[model samples]
Structures are given as structure tokens and as C-alpha cells.
Target: MRLPPLKALPVFEAVARTLSFSAAAEELHVTQSAVSHQIRQLEDDLGESLFERGGRRVALTEQGERYLEAIAPALAQIERASEQLRGVTDSRIRLAVPSSFAVSWLIPRLPHLQRQHPELDLDLEMLADMPLMSERLADCFITFRYRQRGYSSERLYVERLFAVCSRQYWNRVRDELDEAGLRKRGSGVTIRPEWLTRFTLLSAASVFERPGEDWRRWFAAGEAKLPADAHVQHFSHMLLAHEAARHHQGIALSNDYMLDTASDPDLIKLPTHELQTGDEFHFACKTARRNEPGIRHLSQWLVKQAEASGWKV
Candidate 1:
């Protein structure tokens, strides 16, 4: 059948269902004659009498019932599609990042990125509780990973992890050494005092495996180990671990960037060298959307920002 004007479908459907042109007109905020005119146009186009006139009312014929059933679902589907498109049109660029990185590095850097690119809208989401970036959910992700396989990705930074302890703890070590008569016997290096009995050891999870010890790797590179059966504490959240360290609870395995919030004297590096690790920050996008301009712009901007911040990208 030939299609009537798109605007007429609602008029025809309302009149057919209500079985009264006046009732349909009242519901649609139109004149009864206008409703009747639209229904007549629809019936003429389809070449069928969709309703039978009764005493001051109307009843739908078989064809009218069938048409109403089909049009009701079609109208419902259109409404749903409209809502979905509206949601997408209003969506912001969603980003997933680690909590420590968000608070320390990204928070400070966001204003700069915004000043540089005012059109680059973004939403930063911290994923402290999640294990991996759920690919289906996130548009862009920032995480510390050694490798970037199975996705279109760009390396943002290679961060150096460091050991941070409270100043009070360092002073205690100085007092202990003076009493031990080792004040002049060794360098002022705060290597955990004994090979197996000095201080508590705290380590965060590895970037790769269960035993991914950021501390052990850093210590190994320095040819050193904590002196004692240091009460080893493992926490999933880097921020929480840092907080624990701040309270003089334990030595936290923290990266230099993560210590941006801690007071300068609160955390101290062992041997005073940057700890090397294979882990690096990477921004990953779906492999299918790598070529899209917005995605590419974001990926490149993140790399450029890292470089500008003196981080190795």
C-alpha cells in the first residue's frame, strides 16, 4: 500500500483505537474534523474502510485491528530508538584510570589538558576495585602494564617506583645505629637494617602476575633486600597503602608519581635511586576504533602530555 504522510499515522492510530474521532482529537490536541480528515486520508491510501459507524460511536473492522497491532509496535520501536540515540548524543568521553594516578598525576594535569584543548571533553573514572579495564565498557583506559597486546594502544609513561617511609621511622633508625656503635661503620643507606629482621615490608600487587612484586623488582635492581621478616602487608589499592604508610603503619611500595600528595619528608627512597620496572602506563582503545579521529587525538595527546611532564613515554 502507498504510504500516507508520516504525521498522519499517529492521528489514524488514535482514532482507530479510540473508535471516535472526537476522542482522538481531544487526546491529540487537534480538531475533530482534522482527526477525521487524517483518518480518511489513511483509509484512502490503504483502500480499506478501517471502522464501521454505529450509534454515536465506531467499531474497528478486522483490517483495522491488524493495522493497529502492527503500527503500535512500530511506534514503540521508534520511541525506543530515539531515546537510545539521545543518550549517546549526550554521553561524555569516558576514561578509566587507577585511583593513585587519578589523584596524583591526572588531577594536576587535567587543567593543563583542558586549557590546551577546550573541545576535548572527558570524564575520568577511577577503577580501584576492578581488576582489568572492561573493554566493552570503557572508551579509553589508563593502566600500568608491561605489554599492550590484543588492543590498539599507546604507551603513555614509564614510571619509576620508590620506597617511602615516615620521617619518624628514619629518625628511629638513626637512634638505633648510634646506640649500636655503627654510626661510622657504614654508609647512611637505610637498607633494611638486618637481612631478615629489620622493618616491616609492604608490597603492592604485580602488574603482571600474582607475585608481581613492585618492591622486590625494585630491590632486586638495587641488589638489596629488606633486613627482617618485615610484617609484609599487601593491599590492592595503592592509595590505601600510601595512607597506611603515612600513619607510620609500614613502608609502602609506591611510585614516584603516586607520592605527589605525600609531604616531601614523609616518604624516603632507599639508596636514593629511581627503581626501574617493566611496567608502564598505556592507553588502550578498541582495536576497531583505533583509526577514528577522536580516539587517535586522545591517544596522541596523552603521550604528548606525559612527555611534557618529564615522564618517559
Candidate 2:
């Protein structure tokens, strides 16, 4: 049997997702009229009105919802197949990863990936959470997972987190702590985690399930009690927290893979202890396509990069 207007499926999906013809048009880079035309054509082909339209608002009818559920995955798979075929001519691996990882880790080392595999081109899609393999939005995914599932996932690193701040800020804080008159020995001033309460703790919620939790754990690990009035500045992602710390705003918890102490002279790791969050960052792909040449090579290259970047686990 012939399929309903295959070209219109994407337009329908986009419109259904956004619930606005104009929004879908903008996303598809088409005029609003074109989006409506495509939806109309699709509805005609399917012999069903997929959307309930009323005065600038659009809602998916029951049929529309069911249709979307069935077609969305198929569309995704078809797109992946097309990309795979194109990848034969040009080795392209579409990668999805957390935005923080992209900014702090992957983007910096991308030149190295290009030099090592001149043929491979990485198209990174930034997301806050891991994409499901079935979504087929990307050829590969990098995620921090609690445990390994049956998918073709390779453990890239067991995350090691450390408290870090700009050298200038750290120095200033140290001076303040010293003036407060407590731990001072020889050339180096001793640090107690309890002193962290004095300055703003930059909390990146993405690192843990909740904001400020990492700081609490970090302090606890150092045998220091969290002060009742401990100040915390919250951010949604590590990149934001890192930015604040770089500007001497506050101290932030940083991931080992993302934190380059040798290369980044401005940001210094605190003398305090590290937190082993048990968070595992994995490079994974759909098991069905795990052995695909591009994915396999990409995975190997990433694993090497992770190891070289001090991912001990």
C-alpha cells in the first residue's frame, strides 16, 4: 500500500509538536500558508482531519495524536537511514550530548578529533538530558548514567568532581579567611571546607539531581559540616556555573573531564577533597547500529579522547 504524503509527515509532526502553524512554519523555514497546505494535503490523504483549528490556536485531535505517535518514530528512522547513506560518501556522525559537556569538554577538543579523523564530521545537538536511542535524533549519544543498560554503551569515565574557582577570586577569599584569623601555616594557607560558607557556592543543578546537593556532599566528604547560612548561587548547567567561577563570581563544582587544570591557568582546583559522584559518562548508540563503521570509529575515538583527558575509570 502507498503511504500518505510522505513529505507532509514532517510538516504535520512539526505543527503537532508546536501547536502553531506559524511556529511550525518558522521551524521548517516555510511560510505559514505552506504549513497549512501541507497539513491539509496530509489530512486529505489520510481521510482524517488531524488538527482542530480555532482562532490562532491548534490542538491535535485524537486521531492526530495517534497518527503522530505512529509516524514520528518512522520519520526519525527514515531520516537516520538517509543520513547513514550520506555518511558513506562523507563520514558524518551526528552526536547528541548535554550542552555543558559540549561547551566545556567536546568543543575544545574537536580540532583534535578532526585532525585524527579528517574524514569524520561531528554534528553536535545540544540537549540537557540524554536522548533516547529510539528517537533516532542522533547517531550517537553521550550521557551520565547510573548503570549500563543493554545498549551499545561504553563507559567513557566515572566522573570525578572538584571544587574550583578563579585564581583571583580564590586568592581574595583566602585573604579574607586569613583576616578572619584561623588556619594559616607557613607559605600556604590551610583551607577548611567550612570556610566555603563565607563565599557564594555556585551550584550547577545539572551535575546532580538537585542544586546545592554536591556542595553538601563535598563539604561532608571533607569532614566539614555545612553551615546553616551557607550561601549558594544556583545555575541550570555546569557551563553557566563554570562561567560564573571564571569571572570570579563564586566557586563551582567541576567535572574532571571538563576541567583542565594544566591548560586553564585561571581556574584552580581547591585544595579540598574531590567528590566521586558515581556518575558515569557513557558514549552509546542504538545496539542495532552499534557496529556501523562510522559509529564504531566515533566511539573508539571518543574513548581514546576521554582516557587522554584523565578519565581514569
Q: Among these predicted structures, which one has the highest TM-score?
A: 2
74-174: candidate 2 lDDT, tens digit per residue:
77677767866777553677888888778888899889888887888789988767533434456678887423333578888888788899999988887
In model 1, which runs have C-alpha deviations exceeding 4 angstroms? Answer: 1-91, 129-135, 145-150, 178-197, 205-219, 224-228, 261-265, 272-275, 291-293
lDDT of 1 by residue, 110-149 (tens): 8876787676678887875433333323566887642434
Q: Which run of 10 residues does model 1 get worst, by summed lDDT?
A: 129-138
Residue 111 CA displacement from its true place in model 1, Å: 2.2
**Highest lDDT model number:** 2
- Model 1, residue pairs in steric clash: 194-227, 195-227, 196-227, 196-228, 197-227, 197-228, 198-228, 206-212
The local lDDT score (0 to 100) that residue 263 gets in candidate 2 is: 96
Clashes of 1: 8
RMSD of each: 16.7, 5.0
